[model samples]
Target: MLSIALLGLLVVSAAASPSAIKDRTGRVVHKRTTEIVQLYAYGTNISGLPIYAGSDNLAYLATDDAASNFTAVTWTIDTTGTDAWTVSANTTAATNSSTLSSGSTFYVVTDSSSDDSFAQAGFVSDASDAPSGATTTGIVTYGPYVMILEDTDDKDTYVSEFWATQSDTDGVWTLMWNEAGTAQDNSVPVTLKTTAPVV
Candidate 1:
């Protein structure tokens, strides 16, 4: 499936900020102003690799130079002071799957939902079967960072970063969180790490 390596997903939102103001009676009051600004651009990872939104709507690691022309990768977030949850820019809206897949090692990206931490370990060769609501370009995103399970068989939570190996099927990668080290996929591996899309 296709994804935005150089994602041109720019989000301009009107945010509110309070500024102090003095009243005629010499009393101080807080005033508000709404302005439109660029919230964030989902850029490359610390390894300088661009991120891609898979057809499943989740974020994935992009192969180097896979999307060079793209300048910015923007992701949406709903912040409640301490926490921020990822949102899809083009999907109809949904939440993360509470139940894990039976055989799939990783959760598929879905524009219809909100995912905390997850990555697209596999890619569908066919775009028509994708759940991003449109074409493969519209993908799902997790909050702050893009991550995967700790291991193929673990499936408990996500880890920060590590080297990943490319699957023999091409476009697919085996994911894991190795606080100790990197995981292997057969004899080959696609070295990748998920990080905050903030630029």
Candidate 2:
């Protein structure tokens, strides 16, 4: 159940503790980790805020979680000849990453990764898309690019994804859930990953 949860998020990131990743025989692997994708949401009130899978099972920005030591999901967008993408986090358990579509609709949810204990893989793969790959690592800082979002329930209708500073009971501001329905702001982004943000 937990492993499936880890592979649920459409995207992902991590806050590694310099722990050497070893194989079955305990030999330290030297491969690069998953290339982290930063999801910067653009809303009427919020723009460029990092979106993360919240403890409440919704998407929240860094402004929402001021002290949880939050780290968003890491991902790699496949740009094969055709304009198609897949949401299969088939990367080795060492990386635990997968392939997601270029412009598909996905949902973010809380998982159990030490990175944040949350993951959301709600995007659906199309038949025409090609296989995705995982080969990049480190902080990706050049793109505030628009990775258009779609609704998890209805991929036909597009939605503007964003996060709010509005707090719930514990004062953590997150936008997510379990059940599905119609809402205004359905699609949001989890952006711009940097383990050590400028201080």
Candidate 3:
């Protein structure tokens, strides 16, 4: 019985070993197969900007036509330096401006008047005293010397442009713009916490 058991073990071990074949000339033969894979790419039209420290203000400007398609907006920060930030969408058409946090800023632009199609821009300053009102033209000053000037019209492609002073505390902070093209006619300002190299 012990000899029979040992023989069964040997048979099991041989079956588990890698299989091999020999050619007619006593040479080894091997078979191999290759597989091809295809990757898919999707469209991302919305993105947020980088966050910088300086003043404590929030301001924005919109054109007359912006009132038709623009909707609720928000901001985010990128801690991974990957130029990615979180976004919070506002579904209501009643509000257009938002007060940002000390380390973050963000904005959203939409296609439908329902305030659904939103796009995000980069941050400028952390000024809290920035102006807040619905106006076609004006200069609003927030804390620490940051200003927002908005000029928009039916003929222009860019509906807004934002600028902020570099932070005095840490010169490391910088502004970043969205790489996505203007699929929809809108640009909203926002602040994102990002570690992405300054661009």
Candidate 4:
């Protein structure tokens, strides 16, 4: 079976905010704007050496050279049952069960409407059916950062950076996330943290 590990999968909704306007009578009026929802393009192979992270507030897994390319990695979340949760990456017949050399790097980037203390962890690998090797990416490294989108006409600008990593002890890559639904509706927030293995 082909498997992958998802590093950082997060869904964030723009919270409601009031716009103040001055009336002729010297009174202030507050108006709410429409809420926008979006999805990420990051997926991980739990059994693979290459992990994943969130880019542009969505799921994305990309290399260092093409770090800004958000579409590099794509994944879909499935929540069929209470205990049944999984995340799958779109792979071709040729890429499936492929091998990832050591020293490979994966990055996860995101944007937010507010400066949030984003925290993530639980680095899992995907299942695999590939040939076993001797040496693996002993330990994977992850880096998280934010890119501000200031070209918009609105002042409600936000961005976030997050990342994670793992080691390929078996020298095979075929991992993915066993988490549920993608792009969640975050009505409330509690806390955030980040974790991973060192090279």
Candidate 5:
């Protein structure tokens, strides 16, 4: 009897491939290659005052939603810095560095030339009050989430994309961009989040 039961278990396992599954109506249901994750992006506006004179910098311009689903995420920045702008300490929640996991990556693009009238300096201000623009794209993880930063006075912008994991509480978060420049009136910071839909 024991031998017969073992043989039956093996037979069940061998016949359990994707093609073997059936719905209640006995119709075959194809399996998906990847699991679908959901995320959303929403917010008001992100702009603020400058810390320096003649400065009109933007601070903490980010997506409104805190969750999203994606396959690849990327961030680009157009600044006046001739050298590569540092993305070390600049991030959302003022914590964690701008880094991604193995199946993920990050980037920045700066003008590196001369500062224009509307061009803000550095990555971008982190203040909650300013006018700024930033973009990002990436794969959605289990707890998908992202943040972006931009300068208020600078006409340039930043873009980023990467994969994010899903989670009940927001997972490891990072800032996609940061800028520095002139000051302006105070305002509220805009948060954005995105999620993939189920197919």
Candidate 6:
């Protein structure tokens, strides 16, 4: 009985192979390769802020869904053709830092090596009232790596800006999203990385 079960399992595994398929003409059919490679990462939020402070090359996507705040999230990365991607970060080489307003969106991309930090510089200011803290939630993930920026900002803004960044670095690229100005009360730092083709 054991021998029979083992034999059956072997047969099933063999049949699952792509080469096992055949056409009516008695020719073997090959499976087409997937064009896009997707990467994923997940983490928890602290005090309404989402942080991705670990070892991985994941980038964060900014979103505006209120119900999705401060929860586990799955982010996807689709790429083909070349190893490098062109994308933008709110912080640049010149400014090298910026403030994430109370209801704004931003992104952070890290490399395979180095520490990455994604944090708010200070509470969003309102001239007529007290400073407003950013109330957002979601996960920054891992595997290869991922960082998620949570807020009630426009999702399209982040997507469009990412496309623009890709346009800037058509072949090779680096992403930066460091916060500048006054550091918040609960700011935590982590590893950062630059994303290029996996070449």
Runs off by more than 4 Å, candidate 3: 1-49, 52-130, 133-153, 172-199
Residue 29 of model 2 has an lDDT of 41
Regions of candidate 2 where Cα sits further than 4 Å from its true position: 1-36, 64-69, 79-165, 169-172, 176-199
Q: Write the per-residue lDDT of candidate 4 for residues 1-199, one digit (tens) a residue.
A: 1232222221111122233454586444335222111122222332111333332222223333333322222222111111111223324212323233222222221222332313232112322321122111111111221122222463423332222222232222111221221232321111111222233
Residue 64 C-alpha lDDT in model 6: 24
Query: TM-scores, in order shown?
Result: 0.29, 0.32, 0.20, 0.19, 0.18, 0.19
Cα lDDT tens digits, model 1, 1-199, are 1345333332112122233345586434344222211122122232334433444433444443343221122333222111122222222223233221221122234223442322333323344444452222312123433343222452434533433435454443333223333333342223332343333
Model 1 CA deviation exceeding 4 Å by range: 1-46, 64-73, 77-81, 87-163, 168-182, 186-199
Candidate models: Cα lDDT each:
0.32, 0.35, 0.29, 0.24, 0.28, 0.28
- Quote the positional error of residue 141 for candidate 2 in Å: 15
Worst 10 residues of 1 by lDDT: 35-44
Where does candidate 4 stray beyond 4 Å? 1-76, 79-81, 93-118, 121-123, 126-199
1-199 per-residue lDDT for model 3 (tens digits): 9999999999888656443455586533333211111111111221222232212222222322332322333433232112323233334434434443333333222123433333223333332321231121122222211123333442312222232222232222123222232233332333222122223
Please write out the lDDT profile of model 2 over residues 1-199, one tens digit for every residue.
8877776542232323233555696544444433335454444444455554433223455454362533344344332111322222323322212343333333333223232322332343443231131111111222344322332553423222222434443433454321232242433333332332333
Q: Going through the candidates in order, what is the number of backbone clashes in each?
A: 15, 27, 26, 45, 76, 23
Candidate 6, position 142, lDDT = 27
Q: After superposition, how far is residue 94 of candidate 4 from its true place, in Å?
A: 11
Off by over 4 Å in 6: 1-70, 79-177, 181-184, 192-199
lDDT (C-alpha) at residue 69 in model 5: 25
In TM-score terms, which candidate is top?
A: 2
What TM-score does candidate 1 get on C-alpha atoms? 0.29
